[model samples]
Target: MTTNATPRLAPGPRGTFLLGNLLDLRRDLIGFLRQVSGEYGDIVRFTVAGFTVHLVTHPDHLRHVLQVNSRNYDKQSHEYRPLKLAFGEGLFTSDGDFWKKQRRLMQPAFHRQRILALGEHIVRDVVERVDAWQPYAQRGESLDVAAEMVALSMNVATKSLFSTGLRGDEEVTTIARNLDTVIGYCLYRTMVPFAPPPRVPTRRNREFTAAMTSLDGIIYRIIGERREHGGDTYDLLSMLLEARDEETGEGMPDKQMRDEIATLLLGGYETTSNQLSWAWYELSRNPDVEARLHEELDRVLGDRLPTVADVPRLEYTNRILEETLRLYPVPWLERRAAATDSIGGYHVKAGSLIYISPYLTHRHPDFWAEPERFDPDRFTPERSADRPRFAYFPFGGGPRLCIGNRLAQLEAQLTLATIAQRYRLRLVPDHPVEAKMQVTTSPRYGLRMTLEPRRPAA
Candidate 1:
């Protein structure tokens, strides 16, 4: 409603006069941005890839831009186009009416009830994965926790979203692996955060396209089967196929279906994987926190597999995961452009872009004391009441908030607790825990660690 041009919140000096701080951001993105927050205050500006962006740290301003008054903003299509090539026109990137229809129709699949019903399967599958890791422990092999988390999360998505038939399908792995590259390539590489189109057909891009082809074939066949069967199944695909207008009965078309699958695969896989990796990293660092997590699990399920009902009681494990996300948000920052005449008193040119960095916002000194310190206690009941709602936005906010938010938390809590109940991971000596600020802020060197088996309960 108001647009104030704060001369105080201005862009930095880097790159070329025209080019801006593009290279600076691309070089060491997290460090550079953190330094920016330290130097210029939270709500400042900088250039990247020839675009001017406003970095907002104030929770109120962010809530305004992302949620409260979000009609003025939409998902950055300039950003989503690369994904469009892989996903078509699905939810993650699509805008306006089409996005609305897809959002509403897709709602039931991720409904709280639906996700809770599938929670047992999520807990069980994760336990099996951890059991498989016992051999790695036996061989005295170090672990790439990042890759393992990705693999686990991908399987979780398959189980809950796709149903039993799609779980562990060869085509599904190909899709996930291909998407792993595409996300890191396109969203986290350039100073401006985009991957260039393949010009002469390099091995990386070719592999992505090939994987997409296989995935598309699988999804297409599934959609075709859904059409033939006439809305018979309650799985995600059938939900989308049967989704209709509240007033007019119209289902999502093939193109939208393709985009949604791509969106889900990309958005679903990376964020959860990165979160689990970081949680493992933190758990390795803080043995005290890990022990407490173990205590909670021991008291709760006590050797039995966790049920959906047990999730709410797994509060400590969930807090550890939430704290992990606060330290290392997968997306790092979300960019959007103004759709209307203004933001506050500033005359936001219709096409002007803006950035709301949860990475920066989360570490605000005012909201979080000793912000850089890793303290999960902030999430405890009394302390959590001290902050505003959008102050910690790992899954983002608003109607555009991640549809998979609850589902992701369910998987993380269940998986980490299930693993902690048996095996404990020790940080490997001299291994660097470097973060790659790519599509998601993944551990660049991979989270290499040693595993120790817990003493069995008497």
Candidate 2:
């Protein structure tokens, strides 16, 4: 019995019979979690609907749940099953051989060299979009970077993964807007973890399904055309189509193809875009940091777009993104279900779920000094080297680490270096930056700012 060998962590109070901690999640997700972690110690527990979820705060415990004891866990059907209804067996919600197979198939495509080949597209998009803001910059007009950040990142992912650009064409624009809505709705509802499948008539459900339909139609058409036309290309779709398991040499089926594309659709752009949006917000508030970023960009990149080779040289840009991920990791929480009964000083029940909150670990006082401040130096080469391996995991750790990790990093560093080389963004006065618990941690109020083109480098 669970009561007999009581685990060190125990469930604390949640809420009344009617509401649950739903109010905390609704009003301010990150703030509420921070309050709970500060009040409770490293391993905090709570109950909702007769279920217990443990929120692990300490970095060591985080790795214990996410990395060390990773094998003891699966993605769990609660998180995996509903997503399967839409994404099917894609990497984001898959386990066992399906995830293993997909990870192997797609890993080669994101190799540093292969991803570096996508750099030109990264520069062109960052330049065009950031340059398009010139008029606003010239007129001293403010911009809400929330949507702009999405547009910027969508362009990067669209270019790298889709191997196409987003023109202002009616159909492409419509499908993108619709697709974003549907994906957001489905992902957010997965929080409940046990709801019945959303039906066609539910407004959000309809949009998600409709958007998937429209987009899938387009992608399938493209694949068909590519097959017929038969040109050599290096995009992710092409890689997936051609990749063979190193040992078995088998490829994914057509149905799996849709899932793979849907995986990138749901998992790719939002995380990096939100990260950049937050970086923009953080940089604007901390002028000294922004100045240091500008100095690094000017000294390293000047006005020319940074190539992938310039990535390591643009150290500050990398650190800014690092700091951003620390504060607003796209995945605020990651969960795992125990696959085996295990004992140490503690026992992990086979069926129990473990929740690891990076949001809390990154801010915990035991590890980080002045944990709330926006300090890129926290991730400096020397400082970060001294920290524990799992202390700063913006990307989830272990083999199941994000497949798109390199591609995302390549995009963020190049795009930030590219754009920051071109303009200085000033947070507009009194523009409220509030958090929203969306598919990712997002800005509901929109991050508004004024943009001014940087003077040309001598």
Candidate 3:
């Protein structure tokens, strides 16, 4: 649609005298975004320290911004500056030819067939972790489900990236811890816009630098070791090691490979782990849904574990994961700036930031009925047929959509099915579960739950 006249200003809540909406955004971003989406219309325009910001909730607008005219909206927006700090110009941060080249090199590693092949590894990781959970179950010990999922996903990530388990590998564990430290620091930096620069010798900065140093040391050590022992390895590192640019017929540089691997570890592990943790939280609260999930698992696998082949038949399990993603997507908010254009009758000037929050859109009242309810059936084919594709973009949409989407889904589905087959994770009574918005959204207090071995199906 074209605007014949000057476009009206998009409506939004007024902010404080000088800071604009900066404080509100920093305080409770998710809650503030929700209020703004409900109070203002689909395209809410707000200001942050005099810069215009637009929050887009409608699907058509999302499609237009993300897919149809994506080139105009680049990833170099200020919102991604923190991530760029942590990951450099890896696939998660790069744009243009650089991004395309990296994507091409990394594409083969995350192909559907390749992702499917990794399922056995994923299941093995899940089974090993679950087998150990029996001791906690027997002792009536309360396990932090969120931490458990983190460990599980971390194992799966290391195995996927290095083709080896990291259970007792302190060097790799140090790398993982350092990555978490960096992620935490990045989250802090992203939230507090006025925070001191990293180069400053502040306590946080020093810790962040130390973490980066440790992380770099581990990643470089692994790269050097892989080069020394390089015959053929099926891990993603090996794939990157061997990947060649079509034009130059040259392999990626060590720096580039390190960035990609670091990006994959952060993306692959944190998002999947958070989602799986949230899934357990939801399942514990919703017994009916859990019952249906169990019924599907019982009917499909009997006493055996879930494999890649069982992914399709575990329809309800997949729906449960889909619903969990709808509620608690790890990357809850995304930002892009208009290179140039108009959207939904609003004149989006060049360099204005547009906020595309799947968290808000997924729970949009207009799109989803009873938006707060946790019902996995919302993802059933019949129910899902009527919604716009952009209305539920958990992995996002368009070309920059998450490269590991299929792998994440496969891993979560397999992990969920495998665990549900053997044990039930129930939340501890009166335990508070709050959403913590780090670089990825996760449980605030961590999900405290007790595990019980499920009786065999008769």
Candidate 3: tens digits of C-alpha lDDT, residues 149-173 = 9888888888888885232657556
Candidate 1, residue 261: CA error in Å?
1.3
Please write out the lDDT profile of model 1 over residues 161-226, one tens digit for every residue.
566446355756776867766665565333243355665487766766677677777777766765
Instruction: Give me candidate 3's TM-score against the actual structure.
Output: 0.95
TM-scores for candidates 1 onward, in order: 0.90, 0.91, 0.95
Lowest lDDT block of 10, candidate 3: 164-173
Off by over 4 Å in 2: 1-11, 14-29, 165-172, 191-196, 340-344, 456-458
Error of 1 at 229 (Å): 4.7
lDDT of 2: 0.74
Tell me the alpha-carbon RMSD of every candidate.
3.2, 3.0, 2.2
Off by over 4 Å in 3: 1-5, 165-167, 456-458
What residue pairs clash in candidate 3, if any at all? none
lDDT of 2 by residue, 92-192 (tens): 87787768877878888777788888887888788777767877877899888888888777666666665752344454456457567666666666666
Residue 200, model 3, lDDT: 99
lDDT at 336 for candidate 1?
Answer: 64
lDDT leader: 3
Kindly indicate the candidate among 1 and 3 with the higher TM-score.
3
Which pairs of residues have clashing backbones in candidate 2?
A: 72-339, 182-208
**Number of residue pairs clashing in candidate 1, backbone atoms closer than 3 angstroms, sequence gap of 3 or more or interchain:** 13
